[model samples]
Target: MTDKTTSPPPSEEPAGELLLTSPPTFLGSVEGATVEAIAALAREGSVPTILQVPTKGLGPDLPDNVPILWDRHAQKPISLLEEVRAAKPPLERVGTAVVTTLASFIELTNRHKDDGSAIFAKTAWPEPKLTAVIDYHMPGETKTARRGKHRIAYPFPLTDEFKVWVAGHGKTFKQADFAEFMEEHAAELAAPDQYEINTFEPMFKERFGTPAEILDLSRHLEVNVGAKMKSAVRNASGERQMVFETEHTGANGQPIDIPGIFIVSVAPFLAGDAEPEVVRIPARLRYRAAGGEVVWFYQLYRWEFFLRERVQDDLARAAKETSLPAFEGAPEMAA
Candidate 1:
């Protein structure tokens, strides 16, 4: 297999046979050096300057000048991927790769009355002024075949307008704000006094199918419940716990034996800057041991049951306000 060069050697096939075949492909590395060489040739008008992404996809840090054809199977907003795949034949005919991030681009290009003033938020990256082109291989396309490498032919013109959008928009690309958000959440988790578990009493009753009680201890880290399941609760390690009784001195000075059956677990929450008020909480129920220690617990599986109602309502509100951009070639995609 030959690596596509500026001047590919003439094949031994007859001229008429060559006409019947597809254009030859250049297959090799799409690293920074390889892309730069292709760009140089494209600028000189020596060869077509279209790039097709491999099955593995390109690295996140490719230069802006290298417009890429993103594979539909790679990452997601499924609807957008469908739209891109549907538009492939037309896009191939025009010789330009469709480049945009997320499903927001679809909404942006095809604006509707339902989409009001919502702004789609994305972590913008700072790179050269070029729209990141992405595409996948269409059936019957030609490419070079090498060990651990394959090529796809893209014979399209990279227009100036597309370049400008990629360069300008890429600057807004920032990293996801999960780190800071998790830090704040962790701080709240470390200090029990920062939040009142009592406030969640009604929530626990609604979620666990019975009222929950707070166990009297030096530190109120756990909630105790009395719901008896057909099966026993087991912890993550699959350990079973024995039910226990502990002596509790009542207000009247009488010794009371408290029965501890099950232990309640705290749920994990995740928040972002955009929806700081919303949290995803999971619920876990566990069994108590003879030593007044929680040994076995059920998994925290249901997300909706533990999530605060107000947070869920707020997220729904934010969904309505989300908006997308009107890409330069979006209209052509529909055509």
Candidate 2:
């Protein structure tokens, strides 16, 4: 197979042969083609930069091939169908970051919204400031998701304006408040007396389903409590856990945080004098022996309430900074 970059030497061929030399392709006529290949095709066809996402027939039933669903273009892009770019604003996000730090986010926001002389605007030419639609993940899930890694996207207010709002109305443009905010959150998180898990109550373990979340300890489970390693081990060679279920209480009370970051975005920036996120919630380790396998239990203090209150507080702050009315209710996310 010939690569896109290294094409075969030019050679004259018959008209019939020339037709087969390069098959005509629109934007996405070639599947799994590289961006360079798509760009080459677009240039050859004079495709417009603007594009549109498709919709489905009215109210298609389940299992039906519905175009209205966004997943149809989840992996493949909309413009590849024929154009180099979307004809107008797209409802879809440009991309996602599997791992994003808080600092990287802040830096990107400042560059675009505050100072874009070098990175975003290189030509010294006039152009609308760029805004990216993206989804990003951070360690530790909050109450709503009930899962590790906060998948931030819509309703989380991951916008340039929102970033500025989070930074306290662009006060310093350094996102100076983020570290303080995170530290306070961490302190509160470390001690969540707010959680009310009364296992002693008979109603807890009734005829109903088991309320506790059960997880099997495995290599995939990575635990980080703080700057230093906090671990308790009974037997290294043991199958899963130590001799007793609750013997190894490594870093139970101690709470470590993620790297000190200001914010994260596509553009590179300095770390500045930031500290690791004060992701304060402390964790508890408990285990049970079941069928010769150990089931480990880890819980975050005041998790659900914490996540909700944190977001709400952020909203209130943004409102105060922007001099706008705070949104009273939770924002709905559409599938």
Candidate 3:
């Protein structure tokens, strides 16, 4: 016969683990006394893990030893809790002493205050969700202590107002088309504007700065005209515009998605019929959010004014079937 041993009910089993959930922003605050309490508990041989929910930017800096995880929206909700519980010894349930700091979540939801006030509870499942607040810190003091605290400024979302402003800036000419335009009108623009820098170019430099770097692709040894670009919008400001989407990966390898629209503006120079019908065509990058639904983030490169000499040289070289000179200074990959 099998041994007749009685098993204790689940509630009377060995102690379970503690799990804390909070917005990443709250984790860094000086007012995170509750988190500090959890950290202390964790240091004292208690197994308390933190689950950080994503926000607009980088999360708070945390200790190296704390076992922290992410609550990715892509994954199943509370899956981390289930995972920890499943990995525990016989009678322990994960999230037995779960605490949540809902302040960040609340602000994100309501778009308001940034106080570190939170909701604390013993969050075991199959039991009443409410429990005693571990930190007896009062709200009024927290509010008073945090008066006029400004949060770190985050990137503004694209709005309809910004889109209207971008639309009013007139047509965007594609880089390739503008290059070809420069090439086609090379003879007309070559001599007069050859060495002359536009007075407004200095202002442009002050505003946008020099190019981050340039990719040198002159070595392949072929002469070609800039291609006609595909248009996203037909005629936003009376001229066909080309919109290009690209991604920027920072030094840390994080990818930033961006959509840049190129607008080419031409101002006539009164060189008269005797001289070349010289015109100053400024090619600019109109950068909006990746999806093209938001406000303009920035005006990136001052393409025409900066690259005028290079463009003219390349066009002249292509016309004569001469190999273009290789770019110097930095390696191509530096860009």
Poorest stretch of ten by lDDT in candidate 3: 213-222
Q: Write the per-residue lDDT of candidate 3 for residues 1-335, one digit (tens) a residue.
A: 78898987677545776555974665557666888987887665333335544443445673434344433433333336778788998742112222222222222313321223222122221121221111223346744332221221111122232233234344443433333333343332211132223443454442212221100100110111123222222221333333332433322334432212222222221111223222233333342232332122224234334334433332243223312122212111110
> In model 2, where is the ten-residue run with the lowest total lDDT?
116-125
Sorted by TM-score (best first), the order is: 2, 1, 3
Residue 168's lDDT within candidate 3 is: 34
TM-scores for candidates 1 onward, in order: 0.23, 0.24, 0.17
| Candidate 1 weakest ten by summed lDDT | 146-155
Model 3 lDDT at residue 324: 19
lDDT of 1 by residue, 159-219 (tens): 3432332232213211112122222223222211213234333445422211122122111
Can you give the lDDT of residue 274 in candidate 2? Answer: 45
Once model 1 is optimally superposed onto the true structure by TM-score, how far is the C-alpha of residue 205 displaced, in angstroms? 7.4
**Stretches > 4 Å off in candidate 3:** 1-169, 174-182, 186-202, 206-273, 276-335
Q: Each model's number of backbone clashes?
A: 23, 27, 4
